[model samples]
Target: MLELVVHPRVSARHPQLSDEDVRVAWQNSFFQALRTGSKNSPEYLWIGIDGKGREIEMVGVPTATGYLIYHANTPLSKRVRDEVKGRRT
Candidate 1:
């Protein structure tokens, strides 16, 4: 008998990420923007795209700056938070 270890899917369409996947992607892109210093818009409103190239903005951002957009539930958020917290220690 062969054992097959099933792993959770990590794609954008994965079921687990149905609600937060796009938000996470946008957050990642926002971080890239911040890293590159492209500050035309400091805030990142969430967005979604259909297969036909239609884009729908999900949320709104009144004001923001830097990589803070990826905070809370994002992967980059923890690293960024730790880095900032470390500076004060």
Candidate 2:
């Protein structure tokens, strides 16, 4: 499996998702994107992925350096918030 390449911006903004979460999310998203990604776009391999519980949203954009996945959001709560940042309660 290829190592997940998460953008620094994603890490800084969404601390709820650890590096491991990023890895799993990327893998699941990438594979699913492959089945559903559009190939006609001019941009380099642009794709989008979302976690099952809607915890995070990702958008993959190709760059000269390499592939980069940016997490748009890391939602930690709904009508309620808790001390355990990683879990949804």
Best TM-score goes to which candidate? 2
Model 2, which residues run further than 4 Å from truth?
1-3, 30-54, 63-66, 76-89
lDDT for model 2 comes to 0.48
The clash count of every prediction, one per candidate, is: 0, 0
Whole-model lDDT for model 1 versus the true structure? 0.34
- lDDT against the true structure, per candidate, is 0.34, 0.48
Per-model TM-score versus the true fold: 0.20, 0.46
Q: Compared with the true structure, what per-residue lDDT tens digits does model 2 show for residues 1-72?
A: 344577777778777766566656555543223213335332232222344444444556555665566644
Q: Residue-wise lDDT of candidate 1 within 1-89, one digit each (tens)?
A: 22211123322324433334444344333222122232534433333442333332222223323222222222334445464455448
Worst 10 residues of 2 by lDDT: 79-88
Candidate with the greatest lDDT versus the true structure? 2
Error of 2 at 62 (Å): 2.5
